[model samples]
Each structure stands twice: as structure tokens, then as C-alpha cells.
Target: MQAGNLVLLLVALGAVFYFFGWRRSYAVSAPLGGVRHLHSLPGYYASLAAVWCVLPALALLGLWLIIDDAVIRTNLMASLPSSIQPANEVDYNLLLNQIRNVAGGALNPAFVPAEVVAAAEQLVAMQARNQQMMSIAFVSIAVLGGVWGWSRVQPRLRARQQVESVMKWMLMGSATVAILTTLGIVLSVLFESIRFFQKVSPVEFLFGLQWSPQIALRADQVGATGAFGAVPLFAGTLLISFIAMCVAVPVGLMSAIYLAEYAHRNVRAWAKPILEILAGVPTVVYGFFAALTVAPAIRGFGESMGLTVASESALAAGLVMGIMIIPFISSLADDVITAVPRAMRDGSLALGATQSETIKRVVIPAALPGIMGGILLAVSRAIGETMIVVMAAGLAANLTANPLEAVTTITVQIVTLLVGDQEFDSAKTLAAFALGLMLFIVTLGLNVIALKIVKKYREQYE
Candidate 1:
């Protein structure tokens, strides 16, 4: 049976066990002055039986699925003639792909050798047999587990505690998986970054002023000396992020304050969602706007004012990015401000403070930590934005702070380095990992700073 169908069958079996266990508990308790004689609730007994019926069967199904494909592939490879056997891992993978294609009727059998066609037939047969065996095993396990759990139901059984313990372990397992997944990602990136650092010095990658990463394979290649200096990228990133924040912070904060304190009920009901609609608009659409409309306007205005502005300027990208993230800051700040205790405001007003003074001194201070966190999140969003920057800000690694100049960011460089046909071992490609590691570190530092600020403000208020 298919995995989905098998899972459904297991669930049905578990449901049957649940009913049986519930009935058995009631049947056993009825003789001893009803269910009052039982140690735990009937629902807990039913849940414990359902868990017993499902867990072991699902575990077996998972293990079989993991090993089935490898075993099948290995047996197929063994059956192939020595002369036709693949010489390397890549060649073996290719051979297996062709076999799969033939088995699935994607490849015409008459065009290929008879050996390949025969192997495809064998593969189909083995898979059918494997599925049959798996279905039988899964059904048997589920049935046996259901019977055992039903038989185990007793008057004094602590089925509630047992079910709770199982759920607790399941939750812990889920948390462990999440933590391990994050660690795996970090370790993979860190290892690749270490390899990159061995090829290019960390000092040069971090502190050097230029950012070219094209390593030449031949001596005659031009402009491929691979200057891995990341300073220009960092400067451009900070400059654009600063411009975005300049536009976003005050506007978003003021909007939040107004929405939270001054807006009418009916107005707020419609206004908040409409305002936050910007967050739902795709970043690519913002990029298109930045590239087609904003960039041209800025360039045209600059030329009219006798200033030289690049066609793709940082100002255009930053402005659009700021507009895009405004919803993020405003929504978060509005929620935080509204969450402040109504009693605090009432107390402030009772102390002969004006509404404006109460908002500025009382409400703002109480909500400061959350507002700051929202701003920090917006700043991170600005730094990590790629599409608008790529479309509006041209990929020129010029180390100038001018918003009118075209520049590139770390993410842009990372994308550029890894694009097209590139060898993984080359410094050009490895440099992408180095850039990623740098970006990760910078973001981590920002998070640390945000946490410290939040903690300080929270302590002061509390």
C-alpha cells in the first residue's frame, strides 16, 4: 500500500483500539461501584491505548521506508554484469536514474540495451514485492499492538500518567529535533566558511576595501585576480539600511502612536489591516516599483538639480524597502502600545497630567521595550532585503556613503558569487560561504544588542 494509505489504516486501527480500551475500562469498573473505583479517567485509558497502537507501527513503517530504497538499489547493482557496473559514484547515480526513467516509462525500452530493460523490469517487480511485505508488516504490528493495549486495561492502571509521560517525551523530542536542525545548519555553514578562510585570509575578507571575487583559472584572464575585500559591501549595506531606517522609524512609530491612542474604533478596525497590507505585498513587486518608478524619478530629479545620480541608486532601493517594512514596525508597535495597562493611563490622568503628557511620559515608557524590539526587527529586515536592493541598486561595490550612488550588499555579492556554473572548491564560490558567515555574525550581534536593550527597559519598568 502507499505510505499515505498505510498511515490512514494505522489511524483506523488505533481508533478501534481506543474504543475497545474505553469499553474495557468501563466493563471492568462497573462491577466495583461504577467508574469511581478506577484510578484514572476513561478518556486517558482510551488515549494511552491509541498511542500504543500507533507509535510502534509508525516507527516500523518509518524504519522500513528508510532502508527499502537503499536495499533495492544495492541488490539491483549487484545483479548487473561486471562490465556494465558503474565505475564511480556519479556514474552509478546516472545509471540508477536511467533505470528509474525506464521503469517509470519515461525512457523507451527499444532504444536502450536489453540488459537495461531487464534491470528496469526487475526493479518494478522488487518494488511491488517490497510494498506488499511492508503493508503486511504494518497491519500485523498495528493489530497486535491494539490487542495488547486492550488486554492491559485494568482498574488500577495509571493510564493518565502514562499518556501524559508519553506526550511530555514527544514534546521534548520535537524540541530536540528543532535544536539539532539549527545546530546542523550552523555547523555546515561554519565548516564551509572555515574552508573559505583557509583559501582567503579572514582579515582580507573582513577588512579589505575591494570586493571582486572572480578567480581566474588561466594566466591570460583579465580582472579575475579575486580581491575578496568585503568592506565595500559592508559599507553599502549599512548606508542603505541607515537610509531605510531614517524613513521607517519615525513614520512608523508616529503612526503606531496615532493608531493606538487617537484613532476612532471603527476607523482602527479597517485602518490597521489596510495599513498592514503592505507586509503581504510580495518583495518582488516592491523591487519592480523601485526599479521602474522610484529609481528613474530619483535619477531624473538629481540630473535636473545638476547632480550625478546613478540609474540604479541606493536611495531608490532604501526608500522602497523602508515603505515595505513600515507595516512591520507599525503593527508591532501598535500592539505593544495597546497592551499597556489601561489603569496606568487612568492613574496618570488622575495625577493632573494632560493626555498628551500621559502618552509621552507614561504610555511610551511602558511600551518602550516592545517598540524598540519591533524597530530592531525592522532594522534586521532592512539589512537582509535582497530583491529591492538588487533591482534598484546596481551591483557596483563602490565604498561611498552617497545614497545617489549605485552599490551592492553582502547578500547581493553572495548571490552573484554562487550563480551559474561554478566549482565549489574555488575561492569565488567559497567566498559566498564567508559572506554568509559574516552576515550571520552581524545579525547575531544585532539580536544580542536588542536583547540587552529589551532587558534593561523591562527591568526599569517592572
Candidate 2:
């Protein structure tokens, strides 16, 4: 049978066994007359029981299947003859891939050496035997486990309670997995950043004013030493983010107010998603728009006002990024505004307050926490944005905050630092990790603060 058909058969058998047990329990008890016991749960409990039993086991089976190939390949590498092994780690890795492809029947025999071919054949045979044995063992275990679980069911089993507990644990496990993944990522970045810090002193990297990252490609090249000072990059990030917030906060909040409070339902239906479409446009498209359209316009407008503006300007990039983040702020603000209780509005109106007054004094204050949360998130996004700044804002890492001048951001610098072929252990490449670490920390701190504010707001409502 096909694998899918076999799975279906096993599921059907498990279901049959579960219902059979449930029916036997009911038959023995007959708590009330045939259908008179209103408290007795319906026969669907059997199906739920079958799902609970089968799903976990099947999940384990699926995980094992996914990992089995990698495990087998690693084992086969460990079994390779010392004479056949490549000299260096990189070459050894190349040989391992060739052996894997040959073993998996993806490579022609002519392409493989005799030793490799012999080893691949033996490994493939072993893997096939192992898989066959594992499959049989898994099926047997699943059947036995399902039968055991089903047999425990009775009139007094409290199956619903047990199911609920299991569901709660499943949800907790899912949450733990998400948290663990995030923690793992942070730890990895932190370790790499520490390595970078060892090469470049923290004080110099953090406080230095110059931001040039270009390094000598050859030993004899002579030039001014590349400075790793990060202040200018961070300053640029903050300047852009500030400009973006200035543009986005007012426009987004006002738009949200109109949509949530004043607009008719049909108008809202059309307008909200239309506004969100701004968010759907890719950042690369926004980058070019900022570079080609916004930048030139800003320069021309600046010249007309007798102010000098670079052709590639931070203002243009910031403005475009602000536009990109408007939906984030407005959508969240709208939700928070709408969540204000109808009773609060009625009470204000009854007290002779105008709609505008009521909204300003009561609704906004109530929704302030959620709105702040959204703004914080927007700031994080603006700080981390790369494409727009890289294309529209010039790479000159000006430490000044003048919007007319060019500036570089942390993300842009990180990209430049690591973009071309370079040694991973070099100070230049490792500098990217340090920048990444700082970015992660800043964003994480913002999120935590936002969450705390939002949580406090929720408590007020509750």
C-alpha cells in the first residue's frame, strides 16, 4: 500500500478500537435510560480519544522520518575508511556530499571512486534495513499504545478532564518551543558578538565617531586605518526613526480616528485594506521609490527654498519608511480605539461632552498603552530597515543630525561590512555580528516595554 493509504488504515483502525471501547464502557454502565442521561457526553468522545492517541504518536513518527536521513548520513561519514577521507575539513565535507548523493541513487556510478562507491552501497543497504525495522517497530508501538489508552476508558474515566489537561500541556509545549527558538537565536548572536568584541574594544566600537568599514584586501596596501566607531551609524538610525515617527504617528493616529469613529462601514471596509496595501509593497520597491522619486523631489524642493540637500538624503528615506510603517501604527490604534467600551461613550455623551472631547479626554487615554505599543513596534521596524536607507540615503556616515545631509544606519553599515567575500574571523565580518547583537538587544528591549505597557492597560480594563 502507498504510505498515505497505510496511514489512513492505521487511523481508521485506531478510531474503531476507541469507539469499540467507549461502547463497551457505556454498555456496562447504562447510567440513565438509553438517551435520558442529559449529563452523559455524546459518542463523539470516542473520536476525540482516537485523535489524542493517534496524533502524538504520528507526530513522533513524522519527526523521526524527517531526521533519519541526516542521522544516517552522519553515521556513514563516521564509518568511512581513514585512507579515503579527504585531507581538510572543507574537502571532507565535499566528499561526504558526493557519497550521500551516490548512496541515495542521485549520482551516476562513473562519478564516484571505487572506495566511495563501495561505502555508499553498504551504507544504503544498512539504511534501508534500519528504516524497515524502525517502521515495523513504530507501527507495533502505536497500536499497542492506542489499545492500552482505549482500554482505560470507562464510565468513570473523566475522559473530558484528561483531554483538557492534555490540550493545555500541548499549548504550553508549543509556547515553550517558540520561546526556546528565540532564546537560541539570541544566544548564538550574543556569542558571535562577544568574539567580535574581543578583536575591537567595546568602548572604541560604541563611542568612536568615524564609521568607515573598508579594510585592506592585501598585506601591502597602505591607507588611513578603517575606523569601527558605531556612533554615526546609530545616530543615523535614530535620526531616521525620529523623522519617520514624526510623519507616521500623527497621520496614522488621525487616520485611525476617522476610520474607527467617523467613517461609515462601507468606507471603512474599502479604506482600511487600501491603507494596508502600502505595507504589502516590498521594501525594495520602496527603496527605489525613495531613491528615484522622493530623493530628487526633496532636493529640488530644498534648492527652491535656498537649502542645500544631497541628491541621496536621509529625509527622503525616512519619509518613505514612515509611510511604510503607517499601517502598523494605524491598524493597531484602530483596534485599541474600537475596544473602548460602548458604555464609556454613552456616559460621556450623556454628560454633555461632544464626540471630539469625549474621544480626546477618555478614549485616547484608555487606548494610550496599546497605541504606545504600536509606536514602539514601528520604531523598532524603522531602526532595523535596510533597503530604503541603503539605496536612498548616502553611505557617508555623517555624525550630525541635519536631515538634508546623507547618513548611514546600523543596518546599512552591517550590510556593507559583510557583503563581499571576506574572512569570517576578520574584525570586519565579526563587526557585523556586534552590530546585529546591538540591534537585537534594542529591539528586544522595546518589545518588552511595549508588552508591559499593554499588559498594564489590559489590567485596567479587566
Query: What TM value does model 2 have?
Result: 0.84
Q: In model 1, state the lDDT of residue 425.
A: 88
- Please tell me which predicted candidate would have the highest lDDT against the true structure: 1
Candidate 1, residues 1-462: lDDT per residue as tens digits? 999999999988999999999999999999998998999999988888888899999999999999999999999989998877999999999989999999999999998878889899999999999999999999999888888888889999999899999999999999999999989988988999999999999999889998888777887898557799999999999999999999999889999999999999899999999999999999999999999999999999999999999999999999999999899899999999999999999999999999999999999999999999999999899989999999999899999989999999999888888889989888889888888888888888888988999999999997
Give residue 21's lDDT in candidate 2 (0 to 100): 58
lDDT (0 to 1) per candidate: 0.92, 0.83
Question: What is candidate 1's local distance difference test score?
Answer: 0.92
Quality of model 2 by C-alpha lDDT: 0.83
- Runs of candidate 1 exceeding 4 Å displacement: 12-16, 87-91
Worst lDDT run of 10 residues, candidate 1, spans: 217-226
Note the residue pairs that clash in candidate 1.
Answer: none
